[model samples]
Target: MPTHGVIRRFNDTRRTKEKMTPGDLCLLAHFYGVSVEVMALRLEDLNLLPNGNWGKLKAGGFRVREAQQQLGLGPLPAR
Candidate 1:
């Protein structure tokens, strides 16, 4: 699915107006086929703070390159 579509789905599933919780981040990470820690790191790189709790975060606020870098996966393959 497209990135926006995935994010929309995640937001819909979350059903919250606040930032995403840690569990929400976990589920979002699963949706993107990555680990929660990696997702957290990516969020951090994106300038989104992830407090060491069930803290919330703005969804769909990061890019694939940020996530890849957090996972040490390098740049994305050219289309």
Candidate 2:
């Protein structure tokens, strides 16, 4: 699927009014709390839960943050 199609599907499946455009998703994955690789893995491979497990996404974000730390990326650089 095209990137936009994937983004639309993600937003629809998650029922996230927060807009999961590529830009937002990239920002969320790369800078918010999750690492890009983890987010890509989860979002691309995991199924959405029927009982509202959006926290898992946040956890993915946290993992990204951790990866960034491990790779010497630092926390958002204080900007």
Candidate 3:
């Protein structure tokens, strides 16, 4: 795990905006215990976000907020 200073430097906004370098990629890969190739997959390269309800999304399902307010649906059913 990175110390506070290292993490802070990575997120500092005062610094000029720059693209992630190869070293940054390696750091993230090691942190997540994943390969550099996997870490390199940008969000633009993905059709849908991971760990989300892709089944519902693909079938044109609405999110909780949309279903509740716009469609006037009840709260989510019990698990």
Candidate 4:
């Protein structure tokens, strides 16, 4: 699915911001055993974000951080 679609899903379900959070991206990165930057690059490579915008990726990263705090996921592990 496209990045927007994914973000929408998360937002709708979790009532989060329109943008995807960094914590969300971080969770995905951790699942894939990759860094958040790598995940963002991969998303861009997959044409998930329009025009490969890095700003959206960064916003998503922030959202993820917020989500993590709410969920008590604690600070992300050191890279």
Candidate 2, residues 28-50: lDDT per residue as tens digits? 45543554544455565544222
Q: Write the per-residue lDDT of candidate 1 for residues 9-59, one digit (tens) a residue.
A: 556865765666555665666666765666666655544544533223335
Q: What are the C-alpha RMSDs, in order, of all predicted structures? A: 10.1, 10.7, 17.3, 6.5
Q: How big is the positional error of residue 41 in model 2, measured in Å on the Cα after superposition?
A: 0.9
Backbone clash numbers for all candidates listed: 2, 4, 0, 10
Pairs clashing within candidate 3: none
- What TM-score goes with each of the models? 0.43, 0.30, 0.34, 0.44
Which regions in candidate 1 have their CA more than 4 angstroms from the true location? 1-15, 50-79
For 1-79, candidate 4 gives per-residue lDDT tens digits of: 3566545544463565555555666665555565566666766676554555556656645565555566566554667
Best by lDDT: 4
Candidate models: Cα lDDT each: 0.54, 0.49, 0.40, 0.58
Task: Summing lDDT over every window of 10 consecutive residues in candidate 2, give the lowest-scoring window.
Answer: 45-54
* Candidate 4, pairs of clashing residues: 20-60, 21-60, 21-63, 21-64, 22-60, 22-61, 22-64, 23-64, 23-65, 24-64
> 1 or 4: which has the higher lDDT?
4
Colliding pairs, model 2: 33-61, 34-61, 34-64, 35-64
Lowest lDDT block of 10, candidate 3: 43-52
Model 2, position 20: C-alpha lDDT score: 47
